[model samples]
Structure formats: structure tokens, C-alpha cells
Target: MRTQVVIVGAGPSGLLLGQLLHKAGVDAVILERQSPDYVLGRIRAGVLEQVTLDVLAQAGVDQRMNKEGLVHTGFDLLFKGERHRIDLSGLTGGQKVMVYGQTEVTRDLMDARQAAGLTTIYEADDVQIHDFDSDHPSVSYSKNGKTQTISCDFIAGCDGFHGVCRASVPRKSIQEFEKVYPFGWLGVLSDTPPVHEELIYANSPRGFALCSQRSLTRSRYYLQVPLTDKVEQWSDDAFWGELRNRLDPEARENLVTGTSIEKSIAPLRSFVTEPMRFGTLFLAGDAAHIVPPTGAKGLNLAATDVKYLSDALIEACVEKSHAGIDHYSTRCLARIWRAERFSWWFTSLMHRFPDQGEIGQKFQEAELDYLIHSEAGSRTVAENYVGLPLNFGE
Candidate 1:
């Protein structure tokens, strides 16, 4: 197989990159290790920053999102038994986040790609990249026990953190920066209606708990716990009890409990790789970096990466200049670092570290109190939450 570009993952980054390139009249092939059903069924981040929504709108993928997505003007910070709302829209001049699952976004992108007759190979195996230093880069893979090689002018490594594309690059040329949190999130999806209208980040003596909803009948919640904690050990009653104690202390009545639909654990970590491009291969999304889920920037950052990468590819292919491709790394890094810092800051602010002594806990509590009570602090949170201003210039 031959194409202008070979995308090495069917996740949001690779799929969106392929779609953007196709919209610009660039032919690209996408290969995925997972089946189409699995890719579409994966559950992940849900919050969409205003900048991300803009990109989706431009790509003509916002029609369903605008209709089905839930919009939030602010979120509540529950501390000291009081609720403080950060006015995201008011502080950011009408900017707000939309609650849309990553799965839905992937489904929409896949539908659009298929409707456009884009080539996507699912259940692909043994994918390998070769000759990234040359003008022509190729990907070798197996499907249905049959091996095949795809030759392309360039390769976009959107295969994610554990992907082979990143490993294909020389180790000496890579610099890794990472921080693993001491805790992980115990997430649950239930068929219960949300207790509150807006998302809530509640701090309690037990730990940090987040209250969010997926739809009218489906609600999602998370509890911060030790990374080694086992989900099987947590009974349904215990989970509901923890949520009620952490999130609803004020209610005189018992908080309602619903049947648990999905329960899983997610580790908290901050990771980033410097210079997202190497030779003819450019990395986007989780393939390049990962953020702690506190800031809800994972999917948003991937979308941002593809936006720049697709534009660079277009310039390189159309103008016959290497400038765009040459600067792809530097360009993507600026935005990536911004999100990295934001995610780190948010994670530190919300999570309780066991290593932090009494003084650290006091400081965290004081900071949370200030963020809820102080106008300036609330504004700072609002600006970051709504969306950072868009900067296309690398």
C-alpha cells in the first residue's frame, strides 16, 4: 500500500489527523491494533475545552456534539461543607466546557471518516515503522495472519504511550519527563440521576471525590485512593457510602444509591516527551504525552496536537517546503507543555499526597479555601478551566 501519510492509531488523535488531512485533499491510511468495536467502546475523558470545540466545529463534527453535549458554565468546589462555584463563562467571556465522552467523539470521527470513504485498517498487527530519516517512511503490519507493508511519504505516530512508533525512534534522541502520583481514581458509572446540576470537586477527610454525570440517567463519580487498592475489595455498599459521606454531608436524608454499571481504576500520572516529531514520523496525542485526569486535558491536548500537525503536513505537501515539518516538534511542544503544567497544577491542588506532612495538608486546605472564597483565585481557576486563549503561532 502507498499513501501520502500513514497514521498509526485510530484513537482521537490519529483519526482526527487523518480526517483533517483528508479534508485538505491529502490521502492518508490509518492502521489500528484494536477492533473497531473496541476502539469505539473505550471509555475515557469527557470534558471538552472551548478551543477543542472550535476545532471540532471547524472540522464539521460539532453538529451532533452541539445537540447532544451538555454545556457547563461553572463547576463547584466543595470544601469545609460549603459550595463555591467558579464562574467559567463569566470570567472567560462566555467560554465554557462541554461534557462529551471521548468514546462519542471517536464514534463521530469514525463515522465521518467512513462516510468520506477514508481507508482504515482495524485489527492490524505487528505494525512497524521504517526509514523515518528518508523522504519515504513505511509501516509494516499483519492482518488476519497476513503480513503487509504500507509505504507513505510520512508517518504520524498517534499509537499512544505504549505504541511501537515511539520506540522506533533512537532512544538517545528522546527526553522523557514524568511524575506518577501516589494515588489512583476509583471510577464508577451508575444509572442514577446526578445529585447536583454542575460537576463537583469535593475535598473530605476521607479523600478527594469528583461528581460528574454522563446523561439524564447515567452518572459518573470518582474517589481518590491508593494505587494498590483493589476494586474487587470495594463492595457496592461501601462505594455508595463513601460517595455520600464525601459529597453530601449537608443532606439530612440518606443519599440515593443506584445500581453500579461500570467500575474501574485509573492511575494518576503526568507524562510528556520533548520534541513530538522525529524525522518523517510525528507523534500526536497520548503517543507524545499524557496528563493526570484532574484537568481533563488528555483528549483536549491530543486534539490540539493534531490541529497543528495536520496544518504542518498540509504546508509541507502543498508548498514543497520542509519548514512546516521541520518545526512540527517545536510547535506541538509549546501547547503540550502548557497543558502539562495545567494538568499537574490541577492534580496537585485536588489530590492529597501521603508524603505531604501535616503542614502540607494545612497548606492544601488553605489554598482550596482561598480558591473558593477569593475572587482572584476563583478567576484564575475559571480562566484555566474554560480554556486558554488560542495561539496558532508556534
Candidate 2:
């Protein structure tokens, strides 16, 4: 097979990038290690930044998301028995986030890809990228016990952190920076009505909790837990019992509990790699960086990476200019680091670190107090939460 670019991973980043390229008259192929059903079944973050919504629109896959996704203008922060609303749209000049599940976004993208008749190889095993740093690059994989290869001008590593694309890189050529938080989020999905109209992020003496929704009828909630806790350690009753103790009165009174449809614990971490490109190969999304989910920047960061990478590829393929492609890593990293800082700061402020003593607890309270009372501090939270302009300081 021959293509302009070969994308590893059929997740949103890879599919979004392929959609953008196909619309621009560029030929690309997507390879995924999982089945299509498996890919669509994974439940992930729902909060979509304004910039991410724009990218979905640009890819011609925003119709369903816009029609069905919930629009959140602001979110509430509960601290010290008080509820404070951070007006996101008011602070960001009419900007807001879309509360749509990540699974739904991927489904929409998959529909658009099929409608466009784009090429995607699912359940591809033993996938490998060959000679991405050389003049000619190619990808090889096994489908139904048969091996096939794709010859391409460039390779995109949208396969995520553990995916082959990043692992294929020479260890000596990559520099990694990482910070692993000591706590994890124990999340539950239920069919009950949400506790509030918009998301609620609560900080209490017990720990941190978040109440969000996939829709008016479907709710998603999270509570910070120790790293050592397992799913079996907490039953549905225990989960609700613990969540209620951490919420303020206003939020706690309205909360409804039900049997959980899904339950999982996710560890918090911030990870990034220097120079997202190696010769003809480029990394986007989790393949390149990761952020704590407190700020809802994980998928948005991927969207920005795809935006920069897709534009650069189009310029290189159509205009025959290598400038954008050459600078892809630098441009994407500039934005990635900003997101990292915000997510790190927000996570630090909201979560209770095991090492944080009484002094640290006081600092957390003071920061939240200032953020609630000061317009500038509130606006900073609002701006980052709704997301910064996609091309800022570029």
C-alpha cells in the first residue's frame, strides 16, 4: 500500500487527523490494535474546550456533537461549606465547554470517516514503523495472520503513550519528564440525573470530588482515593457514602445515588517528551504528552497537537513547503507545556497530596479563597478551564 501518511491508532487523535487530511485531498491510513467495537467502548473524558470543539467542526464531524452535547457556561467550586461559581463564558468572552463524552466524539468521527470512505485498519496486530527517520518511511502490521506494509512519506504517532509509535523511537533520542501523583480518581457512571446543571468541583477536608454529567439523564462522579485502593475495596454503597461526606450541604442535599454502570480508578500524572518529531515521524496526543484530568486538558491537548500537525502536513503535502513540518514539535510543545502548567496547578490546588501537612492545607485554603474573591484569579481559572485560544503566542 502507498499513502502520504500512515497513522497509528484509530483513537480520536488519529481519526481526527486522518479526517482533516482526507478533506484536504491528502491520502492517509489509520491502523489500530483494537477492534472497532472495543475502541468505541472505551469511556474517557467529556469536557471539550472551545478550541477542541472548533477542531471537530473543522473536521466536519461536529454536527451530532453540537446538536446533542451539553453546553456548560460555567462550573461550581465548593470550598469550606460554600459554593462558588466560576463564570467561564463571562470570563472568556463568550467561550464555553461542551460536556460530551469522549466515546461519543470518537463515534462521530468514526461515522464521518466511514461516510467519507477513508481507510482504517482495525485489530491490526504486530504493528511496526520502519525507518521513520530516514528518507523513506513505512509501516508494517499483521491483519488476520497476514503481514502487510504501507509505504508513506511520513508517519504519525497518535498511538498513545504505550503504543508502538513512541516505543519505536530510539531510547537515546528521547528525553522524558514525568510527575506521578500519589492519589487516584475513583469514578462512577450512573443513569441517574446529575446533581447539578453544570459540573461541580468540590474541595473539602476529606478530599476532592467532582460531579459532572454525560447528559441530563447520565451522571459521572469522581472522588479522590489513595493509590492503594482497588475497585473491590469499595462497593456502590460505600462509594456514595464516601462522596456524600465530602460535598457541601447545597450539593450534598441534591445528590442522587444509584447502581453504578461503570467503575474505575485512574491515577494522576503529568508526562511530556522533548521534540515531538524524529525526522519523518511526528507524535500527537498521548503519544507525546499527558496531563492530570483535573483541568480536562487530556483530550484538548491531543486536539491541539492534531491541529498543528494536520496543518503542517497539508502545507508540506500540497504547498511542498517543509517549514511547518520542520517546526511541528516546537509549536505543539509550546502549547503542551502551557496546558501542563495549568493542569498541574489546578490539580495541586484541588487534590490532597499525601505529603501535604497542615501548612500545605492552609495554603490550599488560602489559594481557593483568593480565587473566589479576586476577579483576576477567578478569570485565570475560568480562562484555562474554558481553554486558551488555540494559536496563542504561536
Candidate 3:
């Protein structure tokens, strides 16, 4: 097979990139190690920054999202038994987030890609990239007991953190920075209506909890837990019981409990690699960076990364301009670091670190008190939550 670009991983990042490139008259092939059903089965974050929505629109895959996704202009910050609304729209001049599940977004992209007749090989085994350091790069994978190779002008590594693309790089050629939190989030998904009209980030004596949603009737909630905890340790009744204990009285009273459709524990971490470009190979999304879900920047960051990457590839392929591709790393890293900082800051503010002790708790309370009461502090949180502009500092 031959193409202008070979995208590794059929996840949102790769799918979105392929869609964008195809719309721009560039030919690309996508390879995924898992089936489409397996990809959609992975429950992930649902918050959509405006930038992500725009990119989905650019990819021509926002019909379902615009129709079914819930739009929220604000969310509550519960602290010291008080619920304070951070007016995201009011603070950010009408910018808002869409509560659309990541799975839905991937589905839309997949549907669009299928309708457009793009090439995507799923369940591709032992995918490998060859000669990415030179001008001509190619990808190879095994399928149906036969190996096939795709010769391409460039390779896109959107496979993810544990993916082969990143693993293929020599350790000395790349620098990795990571911080693993001591606690994890125990999340539950149910068909119950949300307790509040908007999402709530609550900090209590017990721990931190988040009341989020996928739609008006489908709610997703989370609670801070020790890393040693397991899903089997908590039942539906216990989960609801513990969640109620963390919320303010009003929220607790309004909360609706039901059997969880899905439950899991996910650890928080901030990870980033420098210079996303490696010779003829470009890395985007989780392959290059990962942020804690606190700031809701994971998918949004990936969208922006794809936007930058697709534009760069289009410029190089169609316009015969190498500028965008050349500067892709510097441009993306700037925004990536900013998001990493925000995610780290937000996680630190909301989570109760086991090592922080009483002093840390006092400091968090003090900051939360100031943040909600002060307009400037409130806007800071609101703007970051809504996502910064793509050309943030530039």
C-alpha cells in the first residue's frame, strides 16, 4: 500500500487527523491494534472544550454532537459546605464546554470516515514504523497471518502512551517528565439524572469528588480513592453512600442513586515529552502528552494537536510548504505545557494528597476560599476550564 501519510492508531487522534487530511485532499491510511468495538468500549472523559467541538466540525463529524451534547456555561465548586458557581461563560465572554462522551465523538468520526471511504485497518498486529528518520517513511503490520507494508511520505504516531510509536524511539533521543499521583478516581456511570444542572467539583473533609455528566439523564461521577483501592471493594450502595458524604447538604439531598452501568478506578498523572516531531514521524495526543482529567484537557489537547498536525501535513503535502511541519513541535509544545500546568494545578487544588497532611488541607481550603470569592481568581479557573485560545501566547 502507498499513501501520503500513515497514521498509527485508529483512536480519536488518528481518526480525526485522517479525516482532516482527507478533507484537505491528502491520502492517508490508519492502523489500529484493536477492533472498533474495543476502542469504543473504553470509557473516558466526556468534556469537550470549544476547540474540540470546532475541530469536530472541521472534520465534518459534529452532527450528533451538536444535537445530543449538553452545553454548560458554568460548574459548581463545593468547598466548606458551600456551592459556588464559576461562571465559565460570563468570565470567558460566552465560551462554554459540551458534555459529549468521547466514545460518541469517536463513533461520529468513524462513521464519517467510513462514509468517506477512508482506509483504516483494525486489529493490525505488530505494527512497526521504518525509515522515519529519512524522507520516505513506511509502516508495516501483520494481519490474517500475512504482513503488509505501507510506503508513505510521513508517519503519525497517535497510538498512545504505551503504543509502539513512542516505544520505538531511543530513550536518549527523548526526555520524559511524569508525576504519578498517590490517589486515583473511582468513577461510576449510571442512567440517573444529574444531581445538579451543572457539573460540580467538590472538596470535602473525606476527599474530593466530581459530579459530571454525559447527558441530561446519563451521569458520570467520581470520588478520590487510595491507589490501593479496587473496584470490587465498592458496591453500588457503598459508592452512592460515600459520594453523598462528600457533597454539600443540598447536593446530597438532590442526588439520585441507581445501579452503575460502569465502574472503574483510574490513577491521575501528568506526562509530557519534549519536541513532538521526530524526523519524518510526528507524535500527537497521548503519544506525546497526557494530563490529569482535573482540567478536562486530555481530549481537548489531542484535538488541538491534531489540528496543528493536520494543518502542517496539509501544508507540506498540498501547498508544498514545510514551515508548518517544521515548526509543529515548537508550536504544539507551547500549548501542551500550558495545559499540563493547568491540569497539574487543578489536580493539586482539588485532590487530598495523602502526604500533604493537615497543613496541606488548610492550604487548599484557604485557596479555595480565596478563589471563589475573588473575581480574578474565579476567571482564571473559568478561562482555563473553557480552554485557552489555540494561539494562546502567540
Candidate 4:
């Protein structure tokens, strides 16, 4: 098989890229190592910035999102037993975020791909990228014990952190930066009304907690836990009790508890790889970077990566222009580092550091006091939360 582009993942980033390219009259094929059910089963947070929403619309897959996604203009920061609201739209000149599920976004993209009859090979095994360093690049994978080869002009590595695309790069050519936090987030999903209309981020003596939602009827909450903790160690009741301790009095009163449908523990980390491009291959999404969920930048960053990538690829394929592709890495890195800084800063501000001790708590409280009380600080949070505009070498 031969194609204009070979996308080595069926995740949202890859799927969205394929959709955008198809709309732009470019032909691409996608390959996935997992079944459709497996891909859809992965639960992920979806806090859509203005940029992400626009990208989804650009891919022509925002019909369902627009209908079902909840729009939030503000959120609360609970610290020292007080709840302080930050008006996101007010601070960002009417920019807001959408509370949608990542799963839903994937489904929409998948459906669009199928409706358009795009080629996507799922459960492809031993997928290998070949000759990416030269102009004649190709991808190979085993399906039903038969080896199939696809020669493509370019390859997109949206497979994820553990994916084969990034792994294929020689270590010497890539430089990595990573910081693993000492704690993890224990998250729960339930079919209960949210404690409040908008999300609430809390910092308490016990730990940090987040009261987030997927919709008015479905809520997702998280509590900070030690790195050594296991998901089985905390019962639903215990989780609820601990969460109650972290929330403000009003949230405690309004909190509704129910059986959790899903529960897991995820460690926090910041990871980024320099120069997202390797010859004819380009890495997007988790394949290139990871942000701690503190600021909810993971999926948004991935979306932006693909948005830039799709545009560059389209320029290369349709307009016969290498200018966009030439500046892809520099422009992406510029925006990515800013988001990395914000995620790191927000995580540091909200989480409890075992090494920081009592002094750390006092410092956190002082900073939180100033952040909530000061308009400038609040606007800063709002701007980053709504997402900085895309800078494509304008």
C-alpha cells in the first residue's frame, strides 16, 4: 500500500490529523496496535480550551461536542478553608473551556474517519517504520501473520510515550527532559451530580484534591496520594471521606457520594523531547511530551501538536511548500515549553511535598492567598487555562 502520509496511531491526535488532512485533499492511512474497543475504553480527562474546540471544528467533528459538552466560565480554588472563584471568561476577554470527555472526542473523530471511509488498520502487530531518514520512507506491520508494507511521503508518530515511533529514534539524536513527582492522583468517576456547577481545585493540610466533571450528571474527582499507595488500598467510602476533608465547608455540605464506576492511581510527571521531527517522521501528542494533569494540558498539547503537524503536512503535500514543515519543531517547542512551565508551576503550587515540610505549607498558603486576592495572578491562571493562542511563525 502507498499513501501520502502514514499515521501510526488511531488515538485522537492521529485520528484528528487524518480527518483534517482528508478535508484538505490529502490521503493518509492510520495504523493502531489495539482494537477499537480498547482505544475507546481508555478514560481520559477532557478540558477543551478555545484552541482545541476550534481544532475539533476544523476537523468537522464538533457537532456532538457542541451539543453535549458543558461550558464553564469559571472555577474555584479552595485553600485555607476558603473557596475563591476565578472567572475564566472575565479574565480572558470571554474565553472559556468545555468540560467534555476525551473518550467522546475520540469517538467523534473515529466516527468521522469511518464515515469518510479512511483506512485505519487496528490490531496491527510489530509495526515498523523504515527509511524515514531518506525521502523514500515506508511503514510495515503484521496483520493476520502477513507482512504488509506502506510507502508514504511522511509518517506521523502519535502512538504515545511507549509507542514505537519515538522509540525508533536513535538515542543520540534525541534529548529528553523529565521530572517524576513523588505523589500520584487517585481519581474516581461516578454517575453523580457535581458538588458545584464548576470545577473546584483544593489544597488542604491532608493533600490536594480536584472536583471535576464530565457533565451535569457525571463527575470525576481526584485526591493526592503517596507514590507508594495502591488503588486497592482505598475503598470508595474511604476515598469519599478523605475527599470531604480536603474540600471547603460548603463543598462538603453539597458533596454527593455514590458508588464509583472507575478508579485508578496515576503518577504525575513532566516529560518533553526536543525537536519533534526526525527526518520524515514527526511525533505528536504523548509521543513527544507529557504534562502533569494539574493544569489539564496533556490532551490540549497533543491537539495543538497535531494541528500544527496537519497544517505542515498539508502544505508539504498539497501546496508543495516545505516552509511550514521547516518551522514545525521550533514553533511547537516554543509553545510547548510555556505549557510545561505552567503545568510544573501549578503542580508545585497545589501538591504537598513530603520533602518541603511545614515551611512548604506556609509558603504555599501565602502564595495561594496572593494568587486568589490579586487580579493579576488570577488573570494569569485564566489565560493559561484557556490556552495561549497558536503561534505558527506568523
Candidate 5:
């Protein structure tokens, strides 16, 4: 009936925030609109920044990740039948990304929450938040044909873009910035050895493609498709055929084709909402911002959002200090905006926009050319890809 915090949506961000609060002796409950199985079934990007892995450890869920997640020190960028390696750790001073799937992170957090005897309300329908503008806020939902209300000191709106939390806010106070890419990524997950030791981003006359992996034995590959394209149009053979066409001969030769375990088309987009907080309700992850996956920032951005939010909540509840909570939005937006810029820039550089025309195509090529030849440009890309350090408050 009551808790210090009621988190909407039991996805990684919500569950992660709950884990941090629980560890700090804070009372929090997670409410989900779907079952755990449904949550884990969704496939997402898995480029883990150094900070994200550290956050998982703080939540007591990184033991498996540290052991099993693939560490990528660098990745290759291909254009005009040539591959240029960007040394991430060398450019970022020993920082690297881990190739642990987002599903794995969520599972770890879920397991920790269950082991800790934390309350998680799954399959709760029509979840709603109230009084977030006031000191005492509450979340209510229907379950088993009965209504339940949770009184809480604060609310976390981790329920994603279509989620009710952000949509529930009054539109008059919120400002939005968005760009829907003219293309989408048609990706396939397979149980074959990865085409390469590290991820590859390629730009060819055919289009843009990415070769990524979930682990040593599981590969994830993507090819840019028109917004009008359908997954049904792409069988495993067709997808693999299109993907190989976009890679250099060396990469193409090493590519392994197989039955697709999962396939989907995800539209690329960049979006941000001003002031991630509305009174006592704090928005985190897709609930507040979204980034194109070219920069591999979706989950890492969410990790920082929740990190700032959890730190604020812990400071407010444990230390009886409101400074962090009061400055939550200001702190989060600074970093969120930087990430949005990086994703947009990287997407513009790597993807072929239908509207960009021939001149635009040449410019994209020129930019990649410079990145490959110039140490400064390569370092810039490396720093962003590996993630910027977390710095907040003056």
C-alpha cells in the first residue's frame, strides 16, 4: 500500500533504480504492465559503457557481466572497400565497451530484486501516477479485477516513450525536440560465430550496415532499410545477402550466414524532452529521451539518467539532503543533450539519408575520410562511443 518510491515499468532502468534504492535501505516497489517473460523477450542494443557496468555492480548484478560480457577495445569502420579501426581504449584512456545484451542486464537486476524480496507488481493494467506535483505522490493500477494504490514519497517514470508516465504530464510545461530518420535498421540475431572480433559499421553505395554481436557464439547484424520496407520482405537469405553486399571483401568472406533466431526493423530516431523531472516524478530512459543506435547510446544514456536519479533519491532519503533532487533535471539534461548530439552526428555520418542527395553523400564520405586519417577526429569518436565521464554539479 505504501513505499518511499513507486517505480513505473519494471524494465532495466526501473529495476536498476529499485536495486540501488534497496541497497541504500530505501523502500521502493516496481510496477510492471507485463510479465517478466514479455520484458525479457524484447531485444535491445548491448554496447555497455564503462559507467553502465559500474552501475550494475553497485546494484549487485555485475558479477556475471564482468565475467561473461565481451570486452571490445575497438571497432572497424568501412567505406569504399577499406576498413579503418578506431581504438576506443587508446583514445579514451583505457575505457572500453562490453558486449553484454540488454536482456542479460535486466535479468540480473530482476534476479537480484527477487532475491532481495522486493515487491514487483507485474501485469498491472492501466497504471497511473497522481500527485507527482505534490509532496506525497501515488501510483494506482488494476490487477486481478481489483484496484491498487501505492503511496510514495517519489515516483520514477521509467515506463518508456509510449508509457503513461511522461504522457500523463501536462503538455504546456514540456518542450520536445525530435527527428525521425528516413530509414530503419533491419536486424537479425543468429547463433553463428560473429563475423569479426569487434563490431563493424559500414557505409557503401548499397547502404549502411552494422555487424555486432551478443557474445562469441551469437551474432547480430543490421542493414539500413527504407521506412516503407517490411520485415516480411527480408528472409534470412535476403538479409544476409544484402548485409554482405555492404561489407568489404575481407569482412564479407568471414561473415557466417545461418537461420535467424529473431528479426525486426527498428526505425532510427533522436528525441529529447526538456527537464527530465516534473515535481516528484522523475523520468528516466526512453521515458525522457531516445537516441539513434549508431552511437550505441540507448542503454548507456538510460544508465546515466537512472544514476543521476538514484543518487538524487538516495541523497534526499538517506542523507536528508534535497540538493541532488532539486538539481536532478539540470544535472541530467546537460549529459542527455551531449549524447543526443553525438547520436545525431554519428547517424548523419554513417547513414545514407534519402533526402541528402548526391552532395550530402559526398559530405558523409568526406567526414568519414577525415575520421580515419586524423587522430583528433578518431579520438573524438572514440571518446563518445566509449562514453564521456560522469561529471555533475558545480
Candidate 6:
């Protein structure tokens, strides 16, 4: 098999990159290690930044999103029973986030790709990328116990943090920066309706709890806990009790309790690899960096990466110059770091650390109190939440 580009992963980044390249008349092939059903059913990110939504719309993939996604102008910060709303539109000048699950976005993009007659190999195994520096880079994979190789002009490593694509690059050329938080998020999805109209970040003596809605019929929530804690130890009763203690007490009565539809724990971390590109293989999304979930920037950052990557590849193929690809690393890093900093700031503010002493805890509470009470602090939250525009030229 042969193509202009080979995308390794069917997640948001790879799928969107394929769609964008297809629109520009570039031939591309996508390979995924997971089954199509599993890829579409995985529950992940729910918030879409304004810039992400705009990109989807421009790409003609927002038909279902605009109809199914829930829009919000603001979110609430709950501290000491006091609720403070950060008006995103007011601070960001007409920007708001849309609540749409990452699964739905993947479904939409995959459907679009299929309808356009694009080739996407799911359940592909043993996928290996080779000769990224050569004029003919190739991706070899096995499907149904049959091995095959697809050659391409460029290889896009969007296979995520654990995938082999990133590690394929020699270690001497890579510089990694990482910070693992002491706390992890216990995320759950339930059939119960949301207790509030907007998402709420609650600060309590117990810990941090985020109240968010996936849809009118489903609610998504998270609790900050020790990274070492196991989900099995948190029974349904214990989970609800913890949620009640962390969220607004008065709203507890209104918080509907339901059987958990899905539950999982994710460790919190911030990571970035300097220079996101190496020769003809360009890394995007989780393959390049990771952000703590506090600011909901992971998916948005991935989308931003594909946006710039698609443009660069199109220019390289059309103009016959490696100029765009040559600068891919430096250009994507600027926006990547901005988002990295924002996620770090939000995570630091919201999650309590076990190592934090009494003085540190007191200072954290004071900061939360001020953020909830001061307009300036609220605006800062709003701006970061809505997302800062990507600096593609960098």
C-alpha cells in the first residue's frame, strides 16, 4: 500500500488530521490498534474549547456536534458554600466551551472519513513505523494475523503516550519534561441528571470535586484522591458520600444518585517533549505531550496540533519544500507550552497535595476564597477555560 501520509492512531488527532488532509486533496491512510466499536465507545474528554468547535465547523464535521453538544457561557467555583461564576464570554470576548464527549467527536470524524471513501484499518496490530528520515517512510502492521506494509511520504505519530511511535525516535534526540501529581481523578458517569446548569469546581475540606454534565440524561463527575487509591475500594455508597461532602452541601439534596454507568481512575500528570517533529515523522497530541485534566485542555491541545500539522503537510506536498515540516517542532511547541502552563496552574489551584503542610493548605484555601470572591481572579479562570488561541506561526 502507498499513500502521501500514514497516520498511526484513530483517536481525535489522527482522525482529524486525516480528514483535514483529505479535504485538501491529500491521500492518507489511518491505522488503529483498537476495534472500531471500542474506539467509538471509549469515554474520555467532554469539554470542547471554542477554537476546537470552530475548527470542527470549518472542517465540516460539526453537523452532529452543533446539534448534540451543550453550550455554556460560564462555570461556577464553589468554596465555603459560596458560588462564584466565571463568565467566559465576558473575559474571552465571545468565547465559550461546548460539552461534547471525545467519543462522539471520534464517531463523527470516523463516519465522515468512511463516507468520503477513506481507508482506515482498525484492529491493526504490530504497527511499526520505519525510515521516517527516508523519502519513503512506511508503516507495517498486522490485521487478522496477516502482516502488511503501507508506505508513505510522511508518518504522523498520533498513537498517544504509550504507543511505540514516540519511542521509535532515538532517546538522545528527545528531551522530556514531566511532573506527576500526588493526586489522581476518580471519574464516573451516571444516568442521573446534573444538579447544576453549569459545571462546578468545588473546594472542600474533603478534597476537590468537579460537577459536569455529559448530556441532559447523563452526568459526569470527578473527585481528587490519592494516586494510590483503587476504584474497587470506593463503593457506590462511599462515592456518593464523598461527592456530597465535596460539592455544595445545599445542592446535595438535588444531586440525584444513580448506579454508576462507568468508573475509572486516571493519574494526574503534565508532560511535554521538546521539538515535536523528527525528520518526516511528526508527533502530535498525546504522542508529543500530556496535560493534567484540570483545565480540560488535552483534547483541545490535540486538535490544535492536527490543525497546524495538516497545514504544514499540505504546504510541504504542494509547494515541494520541507520548510513547513522543518519548522513543525518549534511551531507546535509554543502553543503546546502555553496549554501546559494553563493546565498546571489549574491543577495546582484545585487539587490538594498530600505533601502540602498545614500552612500550604491554609494558603490554598485562601487562594480559593480570593478566586471565588474577586472579579479579576474569576476573569483569569474564564480566559484560561475558554482557551488561548494557538500561535501557529511560532
lDDT of model 6 at position 378: 76
Computed on alpha carbons, the lDDT of every model, listed in order, comes to 0.85, 0.93, 0.94, 0.94, 0.92, 0.88
TM-score computed on alpha carbons, candidate 3: 0.99
Better of 1 and 3 by TM-score: 3
lDDT of 3 by residue, 1-394 (tens): 8999999999999999999999999999999999999999989999999999999999999999999999999999998889999999999999999999999999998999999988999999999999898998899999999999999999999999999998888888899999999999999999999999899999887899999999989999999999999999999999999999999999999999999999999988999998788899999999999899996899999999999999999999999999999999999999999999999999999988888898898999999999988999999999999999998999
Clashes of 2: 0
lDDT of 5 at 297: 94
RMSD of 2: 0.8
Q: List candidate 6 segments past 4 Å from native.
A: 392-394
Q: Give TM-scores for every candidate, taking all chains together and pairing residue i with residue i.
A: 0.96, 0.99, 0.99, 0.99, 0.98, 0.97
RMSD of 4: 0.9
Clashing pairs in 3: none
Clashes of each: 0, 0, 0, 0, 0, 0
User: What is candidate 5's CA lDDT for residue 343?
Assistant: 90
Whole-model alpha-carbon lDDT for candidate 5:
0.92
Q: Tell me model 4's lDDT, rounded to 2 decimals.
A: 0.94
Off by over 4 Å in 5: 392-394
lDDT of 4 by residue, 1-394 (tens): 9999999999999999999999999999999999999999998977999899999999999999999999999999989999999999999999999999999999999999999988999999999999999999999999999999999999999999999999999999999999999999999999999999999999888899999999999999999999899999999999999999999889999999999999999999999999899999999999999999998999999999999999999999999999988888888888899999999999999989998898999999999899888999999999998899996334
Q: Which of the two, 1 or 4, has more lDDT?
A: 4
- lDDT for predicted candidate 6 compared with the true structure: 0.88
Cα deviation at 324, candidate 5, in Å, is: 0.5
